[model samples]
Target: MDSTLPSPNPALLVPPSMPLYDSIRGSIFAPSPTVLITTILVIFLTPIFLHFIVFHSRSPISLPTFLLVGPAASGKTSLMTSFESEPGQPPVETRTSQTPHSLECFVPASIARTSEYRSAHDPSLKAHKRFLLLDTPGHGKLRHIALTRISSTTIRGVIFVLDSSLTDVRVVAEYLYDVLLTLQSSATSTTTQSKKLLVACNKSDAFTALPPSKIQKLLEDEITKMRVSRSKGILDVEDDGEGNDEKEWLGEGGEGPFTFQSMEEVGVEIEFKGGSVENGEWRNCLSPWIGSCL
Candidate 1:
């Protein structure tokens, strides 16, 4: 036998690779019916798909807002400053806020996103990490601003900050009573979206500071007294008063002390959280609570 076989046929050799551009053009312009149909479909439908996926809603979603309201010196401003700063940074001292101010902040993994909440299957939809934190002045005169903002459709939550060591619980409880009442007034309809309340008992590090549970109990008792006092001050309206009583009450119409649970019946859910703003302990409790809301 010959040492080497006859030379392999040239036809068995591989051809040189075609340019990418030429390959694409040939694929698109091929005479096969399926290729033509696919090409036409891509040309006509790609833009439509892209238009919906990319440019459907250009304006940003109205971010979910959380309003911080409390009596002055209760650490509302300090807490806001703490929230604005990164963790482990020495606590920043905040001046008493003179006017209502809003800070757009990102709470990673705790934001209430419109995309995922409103339209889940959308490619543009996602649970964003953005929310608006509105810190209102806590002075008695400035509280009207907070009350008005509470009714806003944009606000999803409220934080009522109170000094846990305050000598006078009545005043703080009075302020909280007003807030809970405001939340309850609109909580009537089951169809309406209810707002959440977080009673932040700040300064829990102080020796005199009461625990969150004690603070909640004191507030409930004080509100019970107020409801009775106000119920006695009823005044009559003369102009065809449509067979209505002139008194407004908080929680249910029972005789016992008003509990935060009563508010849930009307849709306003209340949570009591104790934290030391001086040490930035609030972030731990708040992160989980906000995540639950989302």
Candidate 2:
């Protein structure tokens, strides 16, 4: 017997042709109308489809959190209760608290999630984006509670609740100065996203209550004064060799008066919103994230 078998026939090796083969072969060489349409659709739709996927994947894996901090009797507790209350139920009674209390709250359906896409029904929206809301004692002695939490990585934002009718604006501004300054320090070392701060002017219904915009102005003026005083103190310490190691200004340094907008330079976004927590006006005025972060 011969050692090698006869060579295989090239004719037998060719693939069998099917009914659709000629048409597909023809389209590959010169695209038909259907092929051209499909190519055009893919070219146009691919970017949009990829964008949707990218945005959808960015939904936060862990629950976002917000901390409530302000002067004592600023109604932080009341605001928390008002937010956590079930729809149609009477408002929850609130009292002064000495310790930080945290509760889970869901975003209102009316508030859309940033992660949502147009075609996608928004699972994040439907789930209402559960978040943690921590109410910390606002007492001067107890302020460390809120300020300490500000450094935690889990805290996504801060709400500085204040009595709009406050007789002395310095008290509110001082506490806020501490909060923002702490946030400014934190923003320095952390590479994480910037934190948001909302000045919630509570008790909007009070006759003496200042509008949130006015309150914002008062705070800016007071903080500017505080910054100047602090700079002088830092200079004194530096001269004495006690030493200043880092920048302490809350925002940009300029001869001009300070504004809340200045905090943006330090990665803290500030907003002023006034509402009567007593009457549920917060639902209409507070940030949508406030509802999302119970």
Identify the leading candidate in terms of TM-score: 2
Query: Which regions of candidate 1 fall more than 4 Å away from where they truly are?
Result: 1-60, 110-128, 235-247
Residue 124 lDDT (model 1): 39
Query: lDDT value for candidate 1?
Result: 0.78
Which 10 consecutive residues of model 1 have the lowest summed lDDT? Answer: 235-244
TM-scores, one per candidate:
0.71, 0.73
The weakest ten consecutive residues by lDDT in model 2 span 110-119
